[model samples]
Target: MKPVSLYNDIASTSYPGRGIVIGKSADGSKAVIAYFIMGRSENSRNRVFAETEDGIKTQAFDPSKLVDPSLIIYSPVRVLGNKTIVTNGDQTDTVYDLMNEGQTFEQSLTTREFEPDGPNYTPRISGIVECENGNMNYAMSILKSADGNPDCCERYTFTYDKPINGLGRFIHTYMSDGNPLPSFEGEPTLVEIGNDDIDTFAEKIWNSLNEDNKVSLFVRYIDIASNKAESRIINKNK
Candidate 1:
């Protein structure tokens, strides 16, 4: 699909739920990965992205207000050797752990389907960036229900072996807000990555999100040649 403006795609929707973007930076020197979460409920909004030994995890911004940790509390990003894994749920660990044991990204996700959250059955959206030997490639996956039917799950995987400069793939848990939120459809949206540095990119994404619903955002850029990474995290709670 033709690349679209990242800002507009996000700004037009009040709630895209959780999103992940992966691509090659404008200058083709780094691999870019961004993940953000938005929520309408107090329990869902009470969150912050905390840095972990390898990547980042979600934590209750106000522990007392957190009603359930089952779906919200888990690492959203993890690093395993030359691959960086990002997802909207605990499946981050599933991909990391299984890949660590010699499983391919697609193979690792076979063990998982969509989230068990009823009506919506929120899709398990995920992406992985692999930088090795001065080269970078990434892939995105979505485990969702057949339309809104939970009895059948649909899984799709999209790979970008030669990502275009200044372009990224955007995938999220929901298509838009609803009583039973709609799961994202079709392939991930192709969007412009531009040439902004980590901070600028993160700032743009955070600002584009609906002010009242945005929770936390994480953006990271990895040097394709050196494997060095620079990251920025923005938490609405603070």
Candidate 2:
């Protein structure tokens, strides 16, 4: 099936948060993809994705003023080999351990509760990386529901791209341009790693974030070259 584009999917909603992206870069060596989840509640305020030791981590910053730090911050998930990691907040570790035990995604996800937003606190978003013919096809979905809660049951496949080099670029444009969402204090950069060396890819993303964001980052790697994979979650704060 042809992958869906984030641009066309989110064009209808005027929500202040939420950025979607899907595309390839000029070199075509790596996929330039990304997506941002925003919220009207405290947790969704002034947040940014930072690179961590495990993977890309998320943190709540004070673009202008941080009313409360305890309520709206979270850890990051790392990307490793042949594994797709997805969760609401800090389920990275839980998901990783489960996968280690040969647990399915659905089984792992069922162990947690939706993020703590009364109305829209629990939107189940998942990211998957699949290996096919010496390449990885990536897809992520954020279950959008009218009721403001996580019902992985309902979803909108905003991004679906395979063997394309637009992963980061597509996400950059989608967040930076289309349906532009407010950014954190810094000019948060959307990054692309790997497509060359899995170790390098993992390292760059891991060392890219601040200590806070680095606290919890999930890692998944798809070794198309070997047709194998590995996934893990690092909870630095704990």
Q: Return the lDDT, model 2, position 107.
A: 65
TM-scores for all predictions: 0.99, 0.50
Model 2, 129-156: lDDT tens digits are: 5455555565544433344434543433
User: What lDDT, from 0 to 1, does candidate 1 have?
Assistant: 0.94
Give one digit per residue, the lDDT tens place, for model 1 in 59-170: 9998989899999999999999889999999999999999989999999999999999988899999999999988899999999999989999899999999788899999
What is each predicted model's overall lDDT from 0 to 1?
0.94, 0.42
- Scored by lDDT, model 2 comes in at 0.42
* Per-model root-mean-square deviation over C-alphas: 0.7, 9.5
